[model samples]
Structures are given as C-alpha cells and as structure tokens.
Target: MLTIGKLGQAAGVKVPTIRYYEQIGLLPEAERSAGNQRLYSRKALDRLTFVRHARELGFTLDAIRDLLSLSDHPDQPCAAADAIAKAQLAEIEKRLARLASLKVELKRMVAQCAGGSIADCRVIEVLGNHSLCAAEHGPRESEGDS
Candidate 1:
C-alpha cells in the first residue's frame, strides 16, 4: 500500500486535490495508517490517474462522477458515456466559437489603436463602450464556456 503522498505523486495530482476528491466522493475513503495518515492501494492510484486525465480533458466533477459510476458497472451500455462525450464536444465547440469571436474583437481593438494618449486610446475606447465591439458575446465572461 502507498501513502497518500505517494499516491498523489504517482497520479500527478496535489494531495489536497486527492483529499477533495475523497471528500466529494470521487475517490473512496482511504484507509488510515498507524498514525492516522491516509494509506492508498494501487487501485486508488489508478483511480486518481483516471480522474486527473479526465480533468485535464476538461471534464467537470459531476461528469467525472458519472463516468466513474459507469466504470464501476461495466455491464452497462455505453450510451450514457457517449452522450457525455458528445456534450463535452459541444461545449468545446461553443468555447471555440467564443474564443474566435474574442480574438476578432481583440484584433479589432488592437488594430484601431493609433498609439496616442489614453483619452484617444482605441483599446480603452472599445473597452469602455461594449457597443463598439463586433461580437455579441454576453455580459458575463463565462457565458458560453459553462
């Protein structure tokens, strides 16, 4: 059995994140050592690795939880998993669209700058007046990404 620290090291996740996963039920409650430190098995290490990979792929905790549940029941059909992946793909596409729009607006903001005083700065001018922006992105910065 590996200690929590070792497990975290092997899984490329922080110790606190591992603890948080445990607290959130993404990871199983770890067994304790003689001094009450958390001890983990190889299975725990593998699970942590899976979680880290999913997180790197931008899977939310709830999605990861569902994927884990599906993992636990291997006999279940893969429709749910495929649906989750499709949803994630759709989210990614939305983010890409938002990013592309942001890029255009930013480019316009930069290109319009004549390098004069702040009062005449195109960057500040566009920023102060959202109406000047070409993209119709919403007020919140996290609208489409979420």
Candidate 2:
C-alpha cells in the first residue's frame, strides 16, 4: 500500500490534485491506514496515471468520466470513446482556424501601423473599433472570462 504522498509522487500529480480527483469521483476513495492517513493500491496508481494522460490530451473532466466508465467495461464497443476523441479533434481544429484568423487580423493591424502616436495608431484604432476589423476574430465561448 502507498501513502497519499507516495501515490501522488509516483503518479506525477500533486497531492491536492489527487484529493480533488477523489472528491470528484475520478479516483476511487482510497483505503485508510491505521493512523487515519490515506492509503492507495496499485489500481489507484494506474487509474491516476490514466486520468493524468487524459487531462494532458485536453479531455474535459466530463469526457474523462465518460472514458473511465467505458474503460471499466472493456467488453463494450469503443464507439463512444471514438466519438469523444473525434469531438475533441473537431474542437482543436476549430480553435486552430480561429487562431489563424486572429493571426491574419493582427498582421493586418500591424502592417497598417504608421508608427504614429496613440491617437493615430492603426492597431489601437482597429482595437477600438471592431467594425474596422476584416474578420470576426473573437474569443471562444469558453474563453475570455479567465
């Protein structure tokens, strides 16, 4: 059995993140030691590793939960998993396109600059007036609040 700290170290996840996973049901509740400290099994280690990898791949918590459910039932078809991955890929592609548009808009703003004062700055003017933009380069619905 591994203590919570050891499990976190071996999994390359922080102690609080491990606890958060447990709280959110991504990780199963750990066994308790005689002293009331959290103890983990090898299965917990493996599950934490899987969660870490899924997070690294940008899978949302909800998607990870679904994937975990799918993993628990290996006999089931992988279509759901495949669909989740496909949706993630589509989201990435959409973000890439938006980034490309933002890049073009920035380039246009920069190229039009005459190195004048702020009052005559094309970049500032374009920023101040969204209508002057050549394309709709706005933040994604999930972004901007942060």
Candidate 3:
C-alpha cells in the first residue's frame, strides 16, 4: 500500500490532482489506513499513471473520462478513441496555422520599428490602429468586452 504522497510520486501526479481525480470519479476512492489516511493499491498507481500520460498528451478532462470509460470495457471497439485522437490532431494543426500567422505579423511589426521615440514608434502606431497591421489577426475572444 502507498500513501497519497507516495502514490503521487510514483504516478508523476501531484497529491491534490490525485485527490481531485478521486472527487471527479476519474480514480476510485482510495482505502483508508487505521489512522484514517489514504492508502493506494498498485491498481491506483497504474490508473493515476494512465491519467497523467493522457493529460501530458493534451487530452481534456472530459475526453480523458471518455477514454477511461472506453478502456474499462475491453470488448469495445476503439473507434471512439481514434476519433478523439484525430480531433486533437486537427486542433493542433489549427493552432499551428494561427501561430505561424502571428509570427509573420510580429516579424513585420519588429522590422518596421525604427527605434524612434514612442511618439513616432511604428509598433505603437500599428498596435493602436489595427488596420495598419499587415496580417489579419482574427477577432479576439474578448473583443466585445470593454
């Protein structure tokens, strides 16, 4: 049996995260010792490790839950898991494209800067007037926020 801290260390997860997973039903509740402290079995350690690995791969908590549910039923097909991985890949590709555009815009802004005072700063001017920006940065999430 492993204490919560030991289980966290073994699984490469933090203690609070393990506790949260238990609360959220990702991990089963650990048995308690005579002193009322949590004690984890090897199964808990393995489950925590799986959860940590999924998180490191950028799976959202909801998707992780789905994957876990699928994993519990050994006879089930893996189409759902495949779909989740494909969706993650598509999201990554979209982010990469956005980041590339952002890089181009930043480079243009930096290249146009003449090291002048703020009154004549190209960077400041471009930032103040979005129309002056060379690339189209799509509407930000907080666009409607004052």
Name the 10 consecutive residues with the lowest summed lDDT in model 3: 137-146
Q: lDDT, candidate 1, residue 121?
A: 97
Candidate 2: C-alpha RMSD to true structure equals: 2.3
Q: Rank by lDDT, descending?
A: 1, 2, 3
lDDT per residue (tens digit) for residues 46-88 in model 3: 8788889989877888888988888889798999999998998
Per-residue lDDT of 49-144 in model 1, one digit per residue for the tens?
Answer: 999999998999999999999999999999999999899989888888888998999999999999999999999999999789899986665664
lDDT (Cα) of model 1: 0.90
Give lDDT: candidate 2, residue 45.
91
Model 2 over residues 1-146: C-alpha lDDT tens digits? 99989999998999999999989888888889889999999988998888898888888999999999999999999999999999999977877787788889999999999998999999999999989999885655764421
Q: Identify the candidate with maximal lDDT.
A: 1
- Tell me the lDDT of candidate 3: 0.85
* Model 3 regions lying over 4 Å from their true place: 139-146
User: What is candidate 1's TM-score against the reference?
Assistant: 0.91
- Model 3 error, position 79 (Å): 0.4
In model 2, the clashing pairs are: none
